[model samples]
Target: MKSFHDKVAAITGAGSGMGRELAIELAKQGCHVAISDVNENGLAETVEQLKAYSVRVTAQSLDVANREAVYAWADQVVADHGKVNLVFNNAGVALGATLEGVSYEDFEWIMNINFWGVVYGSKAFLPHLRASGDGHVINTSSVFGLFAVPGNGCYNASKFAVRGFNECLRQELELTRAPVSLTSVHPGGIKTGIAQSARMTKSLEGVLAKDEKSAKDNFDKLFITTANRAALIILKAVQGNKRRVLVGPDAKLFDVMVRMLPAAHQRLVTSAARKQAARSGV
Candidate 1:
């Protein structure tokens, strides 16, 4: 965990955002990267970028929600790299809607990729990482996971579940003396294409058009952190053996608020979200 040099890292969602930046950074540090994503074009682009670094880089199309496919891919990674030192369960999507307004289809779609994908990634790569005797599981959560949001119920649910699951996994690993450790990542509004590229169903499109801020508004107001910065923070947290990682200034603020003043934090978040919803005409 001190260094990524020569280590083998398997990263889900490596096609873009923090995932892509992690792969690039790890490769620069001489770590072999196994990058997988459903976006073949973006995956190929990431692979091409990684080739400039002096490390092994493998790119593959993977749907992390597919448990069987994830297991098969993990097995192949272990076969190819001989051992897996890191598994980043970072694949996720955003679905913004009120609980009542969010469609069952949208909820299921987001859960399948965001929550279930993380579960499958963790389970699939765990054995290989354990066999290596030096491994870390980094699961992506979000600020929404820490607090309830007005129009992001589905996203919050998935991320909160991830945080709970990873916390339990960390405890079990400690009790059993497992070689692998876990870190739940809470990234606050990185400038990823998550909002622009989010899966907005027809039912939710009306709301999005009305209140959810245009992509430009999101970029300006919500997305204050860069993907590369987020990736660097993640690596540092891993090396420091942190149980939880806050990837942006906003995330750090929320972490402190929730820990130091739970009641006040809850009220503040609720009030803020209500205000946002009102502004959006939701």
Candidate 2:
């Protein structure tokens, strides 16, 4: 885990954002990479960038929500790269809706990719990682995973599930002395297209009383960290074998706030969200 030289890594959601940056950074560290994403054009672009490094690189157009596709991709990664040492279950989507406003269909859509995707990726590649004898799994959660947000019920659920699942996996691995380690990442807002690409439920507009563009702009303004910086922190976490890695100062601050004032933190978040909604003429 300390060294990535010649290691083979399989990353999901590598079409853009932190996933793409991770692939590029890993390749620079002499690691062969198998990158997958549903965005074919983005995947191709990432592949082109990775070519600057000497390490072997492969790209696959993949939907992480599809269990069959994810499993098959994992197999192919190992087959092509010879062995898999790291699995970064980083595919995730955002849903802007309250629990009452979110349809079961939309909820399921987010859950499948954000939570089940992590589960499928971890289960599919775990054996191969174990066989590699120096394996690690990094699952991406969000700051919302540490603290709930009013309009992000579905997203919070999926990310919180990822946090719990990875924590349990880490403990089980430790107990069994498994050759694999796991890290749960809680990232603060980073400069990514997730907000722009998010599915905004009608309920979100109804509740916030704001137009979609306004909401998106407000969300975008919160992105204080760049994707490349977040990727670098994640890579360092992997090298240091950290169980939980917070991507930005905001994430670290939120973690501490939630821990120190659990009940007060909820009130604070609720107040802030209400104020935001009020400002939007809710």
**Number of the top TM-score candidate:** 2
Q: Tens digits of per-residue lDDT for model 1 on 1-282?
A: 899999999999999989999999999899999999999998988998998998888877999888899999999998888899999999998876668877788899899999999999999999988999999999999988897665577888999999999999999999999999999999998988787777544444444335334523533478899999999999999999899998899998888888898778778867775565456565
TM-score of each: 0.93, 0.98
Lowest summed-lDDT stretch of 10 residues in model 1? 211-220
Cα TM-score of candidate 2: 0.98
Give the alpha carbon lDDT tens digit for every residue of 1-282 in model 2. Answer: 888999999999999999999999999999999999999999999999998999999889988899999999999998899999999999899988879878999999999999999999999999999999999999999998999988889999999999999999999999999999999999999999998998887888857648777677767777999999999999999999999999999999999999999889999988888888888777
What TM-score does candidate 1 get on C-alpha atoms? 0.93
| lDDT at position 93, candidate 1 | 88
Worst 10 residues of 2 by lDDT: 206-215
Clash pairs for candidate 2: none
lDDT of 1: 0.86
Stretches of candidate 2 off by over 4 Å are none
- Report the C-alpha displacement of residue 281, candidate 2, in angstroms: 3.2
**Model 1 alpha-carbon drift over 4 Å, by segment:** 201-216, 277-282
